[model samples]
Target: MAFPPQVRGNKVDPDLLAQLVPGTSSRADVIALIGSPTAKATFDDNTWLYIGEVTRPVIAATNTVLDQQVVVLTFDGSGVLRTVERKNQDDSVPVAVVSRATPAPGNDASFLQQLIGNVGKFSPTQTDTSRSRQGGATNPGNF
Candidate 1:
């Protein structure tokens, strides 16, 4: 039996994911449950995000993004499943991170003060270069 293109396309096994619901699944189990994630966020490894994008361009110049889904699952401090959210088709909003530079609100330790504090804490008399030398014959005269 021939199925429609949408039906024939890749799909998530509703039954398998359904079976594992409310249970703490390990890394391997999560992989089995849902294939490799599309993107791994920065500064946060405990969270896994899986995304799928479908785009279809028709016979004309007009193109269409058929569907896109982003499933985000968060693991807690102990690496246990904390929450799972399925953001399926057309459920996402594009946002851009703004990079702006603004001065501190009040007068605090300036950049140079912070640098001086760190340097002052160091022993100026300590010969650090003396520790750099390593290689030498234990008893060169023995040869």
Candidate 2:
């Protein structure tokens, strides 16, 4: 059985967001209202980001992007909220994905090569059993 793709991150609430006033809401206020951010800006220390995405995979098909959302919160040096920006899937830019497969670091063997690879690797031999039996001594009791 196939399972559905999962959704991650907190769901944004418009009513709660409306209460977050810029220049008045502090970092503690945002954390209390919206919870922890999904990510922070790499280049800036004042940006908080929230991301949500839903993916669904179909039979004989690549994983499809059902939904995507991004919420960006900018803050001033004083830890006060400065701006709130929201983006959706429609705002995304399509990128070309290369599907080239990497070759492994080993000899590539064909079916016939693999089948005949161990042809001379092993040899069957029979052990002699006609020898005299020994009773825990160098000389055997019966020869």
Candidate 3:
């Protein structure tokens, strides 16, 4: 069975963005034209970003990114739009994932060690007080 890809964030329209004249459009005007951005620069508020991603579920039970876009708008100190940068999936760098299992202390237990791990660990002669307190294992004649 196939599952539909999930789309997140707003998609940028180049035509509309092209109409915005740099040095003329203010932060408020940009917001009015394109709505709120997905994120702003961490260190500065002058940079705004419109990010979109399409993710599909893989057999490994994790979502894989199919496509992504990031439209970045930079404004000057006066809040006038200065530069607009658009990046697509090809611009992104692939990061290698480490799937190696973490090594645990004394994890190499033998089959026999596992099989007899609980051997003689409990007292066989000890009566199960819980069963006796709960009417014992002997079933009542009828429900």
Candidate 4:
């Protein structure tokens, strides 16, 4: 069975993007032209990003990226568009993942130890009959 390519993120239209003039377009004009951006820069609010990707399912819970697009827009402090940048899959860099696991503060116990760990820790609950209201009557309904 073949799976279709899944489209994700904000896909910007080329014709609409062309309508945006860096020095002339305002923040509201960009939003009106291409909707809102998918994300904004973490440290800079003036920078906005529109990201899109097409991916196909390869294995269980894994996807193979077929195409990617990113449009970066920057606005001046006065809210006028200052610069527009476009990037594709070729511009992306692969990041390496660390496999080292952090050790916890507790000691690791064996399966047998876990099963028998609480064997004798609990005791049967005892009741005090001397404080009973009806002189240690076994059943309150009997009276």
* Predicted structure 4, TM vs. truth: 0.80
For each candidate, the alpha-carbon lDDT, in order, equals: 0.63, 0.83, 0.86, 0.90
- TM-score of every candidate relative to the true structure: 0.49, 0.62, 0.62, 0.80
- How far in Å is the alpha carbon of 48 misplaced in model 1? 0.6
Cα lDDT tens digits, model 2, 58-138, are: 778766778888989999999999999989999999999989998899899999999899797755331123222323333
Comparing 3 with 4 on lDDT, the higher-scoring candidate is 4
Total clashing pairs in model 4: 0
Better of 2 and 4 by TM-score: 4
Error of 1 at 78 (Å): 2.8
**In candidate 1, what are the lDDT values of residues 34-93, reduced to their tens digit?**
676666678898888776656654555444666766667777777666677778765767
How do all the candidates rank in terms of lDDT, highest first? Answer: 4, 3, 2, 1
State which candidate has the highest TM-score.
4
Which residue runs does candidate 1 get wrong by more than 4 Å? Answer: 1-11, 59-63, 94-143
Q: Model 4 residue 56 lDDT?
A: 95
lDDT of 4 at 37: 95
- Candidate 4 local distance difference test against the native: 0.90
Measured with C-alpha atoms, the lDDT of residue 61 in candidate 2 is 78
Query: Per-residue lDDT for 90 in model 2?
Result: 94
Candidate 2 at residue 3, lDDT? 59
Task: Give the residue spans of candidate 4 off by over 4 A.
Answer: 122-143
